[model samples]
Target: MPSTDRRHDIDALRALAFALLILYHVGMYYVAAWPWHLKSAHPASWLQWPMLALNIWRMDLVFLLSGVAFALLARRAPPLRLLGRRAWRLLVPLVFGMWVVVAWQAYAEAVTRGAVAPGPGAFVLRYWAMGPWPEGAFSGSAFGITWNHLWYLPYLFAYTAAMCLLLPLWRHPAGQRLRAACCALRGWWMLLLPALPLAAYGLLLAPRFPATHDLLHDGYLHPLYFTVFAYGFLLGTDAGAWAELMRLRRRALVLALVALAAYMAARSLAPDWSEARQALRALYAWSALAAILGFGHRWLNRPWPWLAWANESVYPWYVLHQTLIVATAFMLAPLHLGPAAEPLLLLAATLLGCWLLTDGLIRRVPWLRPLFGLKFRRPATATPAPVRPAAEPIPR
Candidate 1:
């Protein structure tokens, strides 16, 4: 149960993912009117590139990283303790974040418009009532701030809880038997064990049960997300195999890109061919999973101190960045900053500001470090990678 070297590369990747999130949101605000927001006479056409580049893949990458992190947790702690930690890590933020941070966001807009702001309880009610659709709750409109982006915390916690429940099986002779069953299926095709169920649910049950990140639309997305999270956990635990895949980095990148391209094309055309889209989406997720492994294999072990620091800051940055993006946009909006310069500057400002602000608070208030998964730094200390013993390949 002793900690091994910290995976600074993976931390860099996490920071990378959240950085993409920041860019995406900032890009959307300037160019495309969100699904909820009304379309303007002049849309920021420049957004298509960033959107295409990151949109389809970021969530999957985050989940994959979550799985890797989970594997780490499993290695060090028992299920009960790990589950408790996950809840603390997620729920505390969800409750306090929504009630305090999101509330402030809502009030700022409300006061600016001379509208009545709701009390905290009413704020929760208003947010909870909308149900998860992009429109109002379940509809796919993106006009209003749902204040629900933090949904990942809760969704991930649910997935982690389910995986923990399965941990006993995952740890035992029976689990070995199940993995054997999975292994017997075939190369890469074994992904169907998790993917098919999710695909089925997304295709069949998603309409009725529906998986949504929205505050209001809660049907079945959590279970599916959890299922894939579990799969990633299992796959990533085999460090040697992961390392081997890392060595095949080029091959993995090619396969991942090919699958991702196919998936994107299908999504673009899916309005005409739904079935083809579904099939490709499943294929894309599976291929992406492998790509993640391959890529992680190549880079997850490298030590970069900045990545270690950025990784520690990713969660807090994520929590704070969206609001910052909105505020920065609004402030810049008044200056009539030329459209081209607007998004780029805003994105840069947001990243720098978030990093500086979070870093300052963490240093000034040592006790709050755990809230952001940061450790207080001593002048001469370098972060050792969080690794596992040779006997325990699974780290989470």
Candidate 2:
């Protein structure tokens, strides 16, 4: 297949992943252990299982997909040009979202937690002045300003910039050897070997550095995420690797299930052995990632309008969804609605708000579009206003 032939499956998968994130953030409101911005009035222990199932691989899959995105862009633009474009694309949204979209999350959390007096407008003013908020306020109160979910944009931007420095090296013999090594992953090796580094990270660094998502101090994540990202960057352009993934799709799925089962069993059985738990967790995560990659390649390799729409709208939705969930949950929690109703209502409001804001507002507004990571809305060409034939030389 030509490199330019749109990878419809990857597009669909990306959309699905972000959608899952929104749902997962919603889950954070109810999960027993997640240190989300806010919690539901009725936290449920059962939420832990599903959240774990998704949490392990979700962000990793995104990092891999992002590398694929890098591969796609790198094919078209020169390294310097690509770096510039990426900086614009990622950093603008990061800044815009930090000021506009993400701060709301911090504000909402503060209000809900009662650390701040009740005033969105006033809190936004304080946020704009960029003072250190009360220590307990969510979203990096210590830093005085927080990027929250928009942190992904800056991280991606940084990674893209760093990769630019390596672009030239990738053509050298050593880089060629590295690419060869990565491309060689397939079959049983595909099922297991890529996970070793990740398992090692979990067992070793995770104990030392719990995920801060704070970029600067996040030891384990930097190595793990960047490595997977590099893997995606290398493998994304390699037809052999893609074919290998598709060919091993079923086995990957089987392995994924087996790994997940083993992980779950270990959690239940050991529940305290850090080594066993972390190892199984990594196994489960990587196998599941492989399974999704294969499965997406096999099944979702087609497109529809909704997929296109999702392709466009997903970033903004991601930017917007968590806040909506937090804001909505805060309002509804006081209603003392039963668990089922409250969660369902949160989902509905989140979906509706995201859709309305993304499609109805963001897509249509000329200025606001790019802030949410959208392209310029092409101006409708003006019709030739029914050209009247020069008035027959004006008979004048």
Candidate 3:
């Protein structure tokens, strides 16, 4: 159970991380060539560097927070029950929200690019087809409803399911022994495991892969993310273990900063050197992971006015914002909005529209609550009235 005076800083971190996701996606609107661009899209050349830099450490932070929240949830809740709840909460959204939201995005894109807009009947037909409507005329095939930004749900649900299966064994002595052995490896070697898996996965998809989150098929990296999440779980439950690691925060921060600088410099100097540059990026990614964990452990407790509200709204916003964003962008893209104005309008509209939809409509409508993750409440009941005050004045 949460304490009445809860330490809300962690929740605040979740909110902050989610809010950053929105901002980064909005940035994608104006930020030169985003990672999502295919060669056929005729994307702007200038957006590449900004996209690369912003893309580097964003989702890693969110994934780390997921690990932390998972550990916290497991502290009191039965693991089986918790896992079930997660499936309901996450998997349901994954299946339903993706089915619905991604279609809207695809529809908007189709309409914007002068393709035919599918009505309900045509939509049903197209959705049942093998793929999305043909990519722009030359691309040869329609782009169906790809995962868009919602790939995290399925990936996260898979990780949670794996964790649930391992929970019993993880509590066993043999499991403890195995974990200890793994931990005994030097930090540098330990780091290699995650990097190796990531590299192997990336190589499998290389030339074909764009390192963006929206691509559903590039989900092989999720297991690597899950490993880091599992470590975070261990840290939260093992208590002083995290404190000890956190003692190296300053060093981790320095390494993270230096690695990031090197990554930027490499990108600037040799934009064509993809493999070497990505390797540098991978190094900095790990460094950023360490820095965020250490810094979160050390300094994330400070309060901010928006944290609680942001926490409450973040989930609904995440679930509902994409369609709104796509629509908003499509609406304004034709306005000849300046580079600055496009991103600004998209961000403001998506955030404000999502928050109001969640806090206003969803919360008020019982049937709609599940979609927005609003808590169910029981109706108020009458209670015994307080005893009437004695006639003290008369006695006096």
lDDT of each: 0.63, 0.84, 0.65
Top candidate when judged by TM-score against the true structure: 2
Worst 10 residues of 3 by lDDT: 34-43
Residue-level lDDT tens digits of model 1 in 1-396: 114556655566777778878777766665564452212224766666557656655677788778878987788898999999888878876766665455445544443344434354654455445322222321222433344467788778878888889888877998887755653444445434446765675676556864457734666666556666766686555655455455555655566577667766766766776666665666556555666656755656576657656766787788788767765665665576666677678778888878787877754576665555455454456789977778987746
RMSD of each: 8.4, 4.3, 5.0
After aligning candidate 1 to the native by TM-score, how far in Å is the CA of 73 from where it should be? Answer: 1.2
Write one digit per residue (lDDT tens) for candidate 2, span 1-396: 424578887898999999899888888989986778888878999999888888889999998999988987787889999998888778888888888787788888888778898888998989888866778787787887788877777778778888888988987899989888889886798878888999999988998997787779889988888877887798777878888888888888788788788888888887887788788788888888877888888788776568878898888998888878888887887799988999999999999999988878888888887888887776577887665696556445
State in Å the error of residue 348, model 3.
1.7
- Two-way TM-score contest, 1 vs 3, winner: 3
Please give the TM-score that candidate 1 achieves against the real structure. Answer: 0.77
TM-score, every prediction? 0.77, 0.94, 0.80
- What local lDDT score does residue 76 receive in model 3, on the 0 to 100 scale? 74
- Candidate number that wins on lDDT, 1 or 3: 3
> Which of the predicted structures, 1 or 2, would earn the higher lDDT when compared with the native?
2
